[model samples]
Target: MSDSLTLIEEMLGREARLFAASNVESDDRSHRTYIVADFEYQYHRSAHAGYQVAEGAAAEEKIRWPFHRIVAAAWTVLRFVPGQAVPEIEAPVVLTAETMDEKTMVTQFFDALAAMPQAIFATWGGEAKDLAALRRAAVEHDLCLPVQLLDLSPYSIRRLDLCNASSVMAASVHLPEYAAALAIPSKPSPRKEIGQLVENRQWDLVADQVAADVLTTCVIAIGHLKSMAVVTCDRPATIMALAEKAAETFPKSIFCSRSFRPWARDRLRAAGLRGTVFRAP
Candidate 1:
């Protein structure tokens, strides 16, 4: 196999192993749900532009700082799940309720997703409009979506967003800075605005993002099975908040790609682990 393929496989393998080993049981005796995930999308086009700042040194600093808090919220929720009756661990669900224009589709999609208790996830590209539509959809469908929503603006909150992880992973292989860090190839330069580059219309990029996000969610669930706490979110502020809280309670909270690393080294170490890693096999 080519070196490129080999390297990709290696990175994937390492990540899988790390996630597999993360399974540990919490002190509670309730049945562990492993993982529960939700997706966020912006309804106002202006809000979508904020994510564009995610390109340079600005992007790195932006992500490195406050985003921990956003991830922390997800952690906070997961930490308390034993006391609450979270929705069943159904098949994964995806929602795209970013604007009023998408009302018809969002309504239909919400109906379909609500029926799938095993899995449900969704995304939107605007802020107020998108969130409003989602609220309506939830109410109309007799579901509740009153949880905290992730807003990418204000630059104060940080979200450990995985929406761009596949691109980052793919680009790291070829870009000089990320390539060297990841020990991979540099990507060819692109000739489009950041907005244009991330247009969902580019089906290929969208698919990669969705796959990466879903995989991250699954890995997180596996960790939950081990009794380790799991947190998730789509906005930087929420992630930063979650991570910050986790850091206080756990010793080694780490934020990389879209998911997080265990903070406590001693809590329920390796409790529900089925294997040493996760893969399609």
Candidate 2:
């Protein structure tokens, strides 16, 4: 392992030990593990030229359509011991294509995710973008998606999309912006510029960005869980009332906007209420 990875593992271990020591009541509790993941893709107009032309479109129109190709993927598993305040962190895992081949990169990405079975996989905007793109890419590449991700269910706990949760709670759904709002550290490489780096063959930079994104995702998820555990409310109606009051009190604040919805949903879910749908009064 790289020195950085080793150091991260040490840090996680230290945190785990400290948590155990502080929460002695949970010493004998059993825990489940969940994986937090993020993926970065490069979109190129050249890859879809043939498909575009086949649809009877002019050459100029064909250039407008781009194909999204998975270039990097990163994930980390968290140990969720029952009665613990937060999950135990683990060193992140990253996958990238050495040759910049989409098929190889996509295959490896899915394979890594598939390796972790029975573990909840979480991501930011994964359902609408990351996983959706992956599903399409896997089909194009003739690759089989993991069963956990392929299951089409409204309440599939196997994969949690933090972005969707944020949307449900009416919070800012943008990953970097949301992370910033939560005071999480910034990524080494900005996600917006990653595609340019990929085009320039800066694999190292891409890997660094992916690593940072995945770690940030894990941190955000932990924060979400922690926040949910501390909420005291009777029903979604009460939470919505409080949200409206906050909005009226602080019009320019994120807490007063749609961004508050996801946070509210997270708390509601933690309170054993079904938070998948948000009903407005």
Candidate 3:
């Protein structure tokens, strides 16, 4: 096999082992699945220019740049059976199409998610950016959005925006910053860099970066939902100090709820600690 193929196989193997060794219990009764995803898109500069022209060159230009096309998307789906300690983590899925067929890529990505059973889609800033852009793109392209993505109820748990959630709790909301604060590894590529790759028509590299973002988001969600510790303190400074210390002392095991939960049950198991070690606040 070519070296590139070998490397891909090795990476897949490593991810498989990581999932297999997770502290997965067989008691899952919720019968729900989770999809953690991220999307990368480019602005429609021409559309903006057209709007400016149509308004006779004097109308106030809309500052909100519409992401009318989806350049790339990546997601990781986890099947959570109620009562199970660890959900089944699927391999990362990435989609990046040629410029002419970008909408088709978006459709296919959503279609895959729609086909899944009882899935909940989660993203860090998806509500403000990714999902909104996707809905608009789907309409512009005359493609139908999956029901899972179309539901807009404020209380719906089917779609989760971690950034929004953090904002509600008045905590740090940026994904990369939050991940860093929680000791999750940084993204493989910077967000600004993806635009340059898109400009250069490097879809493969863009896909790779998006995949890394998706995986990082998935890990963060897992840590947030399953392993984060809730510590109560009278002073905000004390909370910050505790969070920093936990992240530094137990990069993989302990996570603070103040910055967002850092410790997952799997992390505790990996650290050879009992679940009871984390006391409820």
Candidate 4:
């Protein structure tokens, strides 16, 4: 493994072992794991063109889900263990490369998720957009998908669509709006710019945007869980503090790319965050 990946593994080491133990026998303690996922995709011109050429005037690929190709997929692990003030948020992880094709990128993204199928996969627009797009991409590439993701019901134990889970406050609002309600820092480059970034091979920016989405989804999930009493944790004030800590720690950090720092740090400073973020070796 690369040094960076090794570090991430180390960061997750204790939870990794505990997860193994939980499988063999229930510890009789309350614990849960969530993989907050999000991704950035570019509209596939080829698919658009194929529709245009085949149907002439009838072709309209300007806005279609199947034509969207995954460019960056990002996630962060949240370990909701007892005896902790709040869920332990893992360092945000992103899968993307400027040179990687959609096939390889989607493959790696699913491979990572397949490694932890039982973990609850949470997202803002996950059901309607992210996973749907993934399913289409897998078909296009003949890639094997984890059954955990393919047929997940919203109420299924394996998946939760924050976007649609709630009655009004959640399903009716957008991801950014929900995040703003929770006071989380979620602003990144506009979604419209993703295509140009891909065209310019600006994978870092795309990755950052996806990572920010993942983080926002995670924090919002925590907030939602707290409201539902599904997971117990610290008070609202304390949880918000830890969420900010995660914002500072990830997106732009000591161990990974800083391409996100200039944009993210300014928001941090505006929010009055100072000092370097400490990560254990």
The best candidate by lDDT is 4
Using TM-score as the measure, the top candidate is 4
TM-score-based ranking:
4, 3, 2, 1
Q: 32-142, model 2: which lDDT tens digit per residue?
A: 456777777766666576666666544445222136777787776776655544345555566676555777767766665555555567888777667777777777887
Q: Once all C-alphas are superposed, what RMSD does model 3 give against the true structure?
A: 13.3
Candidate 1, poorest ten consecutive residues by summed lDDT = 67-76
Per-candidate local distance difference test: 0.32, 0.61, 0.60, 0.68
Better of 2 and 4 by TM-score: 4
> How high a TM-score does candidate 4 get?
0.72
The order by descending lDDT is 4, 2, 3, 1
lDDT of 1 by residue, 1-281 (tens): 69899778756754553343233222333433222333322234343346545553444332221111110001112322343323223333333322222444444443443332222132211132334445544455544332122233412111222223324345322123432353221112231321243344443332223323333344333323333233332222322333334334433212222233232221123323455633231
Off by over 4 Å in 4: 1-29, 152-154, 167-171, 235-281
TM-scores for the candidates:
0.29, 0.62, 0.66, 0.72
- After superposition, which runs of candidate 2 have C-alpha atoms over 4 Å from their true positions? 1-30, 56-66, 83-88, 169-172, 230-281
lDDT of 3 by residue, 1-281 (tens): 69999778756754553344231212333455678888777767787777778987685565353735677877767665454445555655667766546677777777776565246788887877777787778778877666556567743556777777666757646677887776564455666677788878887677666765665576656555553331111222222233343344334321122222333333434456545555443
Candidate 4 lDDT, 1-101, residue by residue in tens = 69999768655753564366446336433677778888887777876887899898887746688888888887777778777876777666677767677
